[model samples]
Target: MKLLYLSYLNSFKGLSREVWWLALVTLINRAGTMVIPFLSLYLTQDRGFSLEDVGTIMSCFGLGSLAGTWLGGKLTDRIGYYKVMVWSLFLTGVLFIWLQMLESFYAICSGIFVLMVIADSFRPATYVAMSAYSKHENKTRSVTLIRLAINLGFSAGPAIGGVIIASVGYFGLFWIDGVTCLLAALLLLLVLNPKKAKELDQVKNEAPRSAYSDYPYLLFIGAMVLLGLIFVQYFSTVPLFYSEMRSLSEVGIGLLLAMNGFIIFVFEMPLIKYLETSTLSRTSLMIIGLAMTTFSFFFLTIGTWTGLLVIGMILMTLGEMITFPFSSAFAMDRSRSGRQGEYMALYNIAFSISHIFAHNGGMVSIANFGYKSTWYLAMIIGVMGILLLYALRYRLQTSRKK
Candidate 1:
C-alpha cells in the first residue's frame, strides 16, 4: 500500500514549474465554471425560455467559441501567447458579470455569444504555453496535469454551483463566475512572468504549415467532432435526464455530475502515466477510449435504474481520461515547430463545432423522439467515430512505412 501510494505520487515528478503555474491558472478559472453546466436549466426554469430557445442560445455560445478559438490561434501566432492569455482571461471575467444583466431572449443570446468568444480564446493560447513550458517527454503528462486541474475544478464547481443556486439564486452564479475569472487572470499575470520566460515569444525555426492543408489532421478533427458530440451531452442533456427521468433534485444532479469529475481527478493522471509506457499507438488507445464512451450511452439504454447513471458516468470519465491527453499530445506532435497555435486551435475548434450540434441536436432529439432515442443516436455517432479513427490509424501507419 505504501509503495503503491508512492508510485502514484511519483507520476507527478519532473514537471517544470511553469507547467504547474499554468495548471494553477486553469484550476482557478475552471473552478468557477458554474454557469455553463447549469445554463440549460437556468434558461428553462429561471428565464422561462422554451427548450428550443435554449437550444438557439446554446448554439450561439458554440458559434462564439468557434470564432474565439480561431482568433486566439491567429493572435497567438502573431502577437505571442502571453498577451492573448491575459487579455482573454480578464475580458472574459468582465463579460461573465455583464451577461447577467440581459433579460430578453435575443439579448441573452448575444451576451452568451460574446462571453464565450472571450472566454474560450484562452484555450489554444494555454496549449501553446504548455508546449513552450513542458519538456518534450513530459508533454502528455503536463496536459494531463492541466486536465486534472480542470476536472478537479469541475468536481467542485458543479456541486458548489448547485448549492449556490439553491441558496442565492442564478443571479449569484454570474458574479462568482466573473470573480473567479478575474482572479485567475491576476494570478497568471503575477505568477507566470512572461518577461522571465522569453522563450514563449521565440520563433520556431522549423517550417510552418497551415492546419487547413493537413488532410489526415482534418480527418482526425472530424472524428473528434463526432466524439465531442457524444461526450458533451453530459453538460447539456444529462442534467435534464437526472431531473426529469430520475427525479433527482438540483443538489442530487450536481453531485452526480461532480462524480464524473471526482473519478477523473483521482484516476486520470495515474492512468496516463501508465499508458505513456505502453507500446500501443495513440490511435489504438483512442479507439479503446471511444469504445468505452460509446458503451456509456449503451449503458443508459439498458435500464432506467439510477445505478446506470453512475455506471455510465464512470465509463465516460475513463474514456475521456484515456482519450483527451493522448489526443492532445498527438496533436502537439503533429504540429510543425511554429504553428502549434493554429494546430491546437483547430483541435479545440472541433469541440466548439460539436457544442453547436450537441446542445441543439441533443435537445431537439429529446423534444421530438425522447431521451432513449437520443442515446441510441449518440451511440451510432460514436460507432462511426470509432471507425473513422481506425481508418486514421491505418493511414498514419501507411504514411510511416512509406
Candidate 2:
C-alpha cells in the first residue's frame, strides 16, 4: 500500500531530463548484470576451481575496476565524459564476448581483469555526468534516483539470472549482459551527446592538483573504504555462506540477494527525504547508517535461519540506502571545483580496497573460521566505521558551510 509514498514520489519532480536519461542508461546496464552475483558459483561448481582461486580471480576484477576508474577520470578531464562513456560501454560488451571463449584458469582470470577494467571505467564518468546534469539543489535526489534505477535493475537481474542459470547455464548471462551493455551505450550516445548539459555542468578549465592535497578528502576515502569493506561482505561472503554452509540452493541465494535491491528500491528515497527535511547532517546520517549496518551483521551471529536473513537484509538495505548516495553527494560537495571526476575516482578507491580484502579475506575467513566469526568481523568493522565518521563530523560540517 505504501509503495507509492507521496514524499518519495515527489522527490522526482524537479530533476532534469538529462538526469533521467543517465538513470535510464544505468537501469539498462544494471538490469543485465547477472554475471557477478553468480560468479562464485560458476567458478566453483562449474569450472571446478577452488575457493582460493575464485577469490584471487575476483580480486583481479577488483584490480581492473580500480585501474578503470582512475583512467576514466583522467580521460574525462581530457577528452570529456561523453567519449569516455561511449568507448567504455562499447569495449566492455566486446570483452564479455571474448571472456566467454577463454577456457584456461589463467586466461579466464586475465580476461576477467581486462573486461572489468573496461567496464567499470563507466562508473566515475556516470557520477561526473550525473553531477554535471543535475541542478545543485536537486543533486542528492538526482543521485538517489540513479541508485534507485540501479537497485531496481539489480532486483530484476538476479531473478532473471536465477532462471537463466537453470536453463541455458552461465553462458547466457554473459551474452545478455554484453548485449545490454551495448544497448546502454547506444542510449547514452543518442541522448547524452555533445549537445547536452553544457551550462548546468561546471566549466572545467584549470589544470588539477592531486586529491591527496585535501587532507579531509583523504580521511573521507578511508571512511569510505571501511564502509565498503563492511557491506561488500554481503555480496561475496554472504552468498558463499548460504550456498556452501547453509545448503541453500542457487535460487534461494538469488532471492536473498534480490531482496536487498528490492528493499532499497521501495524505501530509500522516502527515508532520505525524511533525513533531509530534518536537521540531520550528512556525517550524522552516515553514522546512523553504519550503526544499522553493524547491527544487521549482529543478527547473522544467530544460526542461519531464513527469518534472520530477511531481517538482516532489510537492516543492511536501509543502511545502504542512507549511506551511499549522500556519501557521493558529500564527495561532490567536498571536491574543489573542476576536478569532480578525479575526486570521485579517488572516492572509489574505497570500493577497490574492499573488493580485494573482502573477497580475499572473506573467502579465507569462511574456509577457516566459519560463518559466525566472519559476521562478527563485519560487525566489528562496521562499528569502527561509525566511530571514524563521528570523529570526522567537524571536517564535514566545515566543508558544508563553505
Candidate 3:
C-alpha cells in the first residue's frame, strides 16, 4: 500500500505549477455545473415545455458551442488564450444569473443560446493554455490531470446540486453556478498571466496549417463526434432515465451520476500513468475504450436492476478515462505552433456537434420508442465509432511508412 501510494504521487511529479492552477480553475468552474445536467427536467417539469421544445433549446446550445469554440480559437491565435478565458468566464457568470429570469419558451431558448456562446468559448482557449503550460512528454498526463479536476468537481457538483434543487428550487442552482463562475474568473486573474504563458510555451515557430484542410485529423474528429454523441447522453438524458424509468429520486439520480465522476477522479490518473508507459498505441487504447462504452449500453438493456446502473457507470467511466486524455494529446500533437488554437477548436467543435445531436436525438428516441430503444441506438453509434477509429489508425500507419 505504501508503494502504491508513492506511485500515485509520482504520477503528478513532473507537471508545472501553471498546469495545477489551470486544473484548479477548471475545478472551480465545473463545481457549479448544475444547470445543464438538469435543464431538460427543469424545462419540462417546471416550465411546462414539451420534450420537443427541450430538444430545440438544447440544439441551440450546440449551435452556440460551435460558434463559441470557433470564435475562441480565432481570438486565441490572434490575441492569446489568457484574455479569451478571462472574458469568457466573467461574461458567462453574468449571463447565468440573468438566465433564470426568462419565462417564455422562445425567450428561454434565446437566452440559453447566447449564454452557451459566452460559456463554451472557454473550451478551446483552455486547450491552448494547456499546450502552453505542459511539456511535450507529459502532455497526455497533463490533460488527464485537468480531467481529474473536472471529475472531482463533478462528483461533488451533482450531489450538492441535488440538495440545492430540493431546498431552494432550480433558480438557486443558477445563482450558485453564476457565483462560482465569477469566483473562478477572479482566481484565474490572480494566478496565470498572459506574458508568462507566452514565455512558457515551448513551440516557438512552425508553419501555419488550417485544421479544415487536414484530412486525417478531420477523420479522427469524425470518430470523436460519433463517440461524443453516445457519451453525452449521461449528462442530457440519462438522469431522466434514472428518474422516470427506474423511479429514482433526484438525489438518487445525482448519486448515480456522481459515481461516474468519483470513479474517474480516483482511478483515471493512475490508469493513465500506467497506460503512458505501455506499448499500445493511442488509437488502440481508444478502440478498447470505445468497446467498453458500447457494452455499457448493453448492460442497461439487460434489465431494470439498479445494480446494472452502477456496473454500467463504472464501465463508462473507465472508457472515458482511457479515451479522452489520449484524444486530447493527439489533437495537440497534430497542431502546428501557430495554429494550436484552431486545431483544438476544431476538435472541440466535433463534440459540440455531438451535443447538438445527442440531446435532441436521445430525447426523440426515448419519447418515440422508449428507454430500451435509446440504449440500443447508443450501442450502434459506439460500434460505428470503434470502426472509424480503426480506419484512422490504418491511415496513420500508412502515412508513417511513407
lDDT of 1: 0.87
Assess every candidate by TM-score.
Answer: 0.88, 0.87, 0.88
Q: After superposition, which runs of candidate 2 have C-alpha atoms over 4 Å from their true positions?
A: 1-5, 38-55, 162-172, 197-199, 203-207, 239-256, 302-309, 336-338, 366-371, 397-402
Candidate 2 per-residue lDDT over residues 1-402, each given as its tens digit: 465666667867878889998899999888877788898898898888998898788878888989988888778777777888889989988887668788888998999888888887788888888888877777788889999898778777888999998999998988988898899989888988877544475755476666768777777788889899889888878888777767889999879887886777777777776677778878888888878888998877787677887788889988888899889888877654547678878887678878777766887887898888988888888888877787689776777799
Q: Tens digits of per-residue lDDT for model 1 on 220-315?
A: 898999999999998889889879988989988878877777777777888988998999889999999989999998777777788888888889
| Residue 227 lDDT (model 1) | 96
Ten contiguous residues with the weakest lDDT in model 3: 195-204
How should the candidates be ordered by lDDT, best one leading? 1, 3, 2
Q: Which model, 1 or 2, shows the larger lDDT?
A: 1
lDDT of 3: 0.87
- The lDDT values for all models are 0.87, 0.82, 0.87
Scored against the true structure, residue 43 in model 3 reaches a CA lDDT of: 94
Model 3: how far is 131 from its true place, Å?
Answer: 1.2
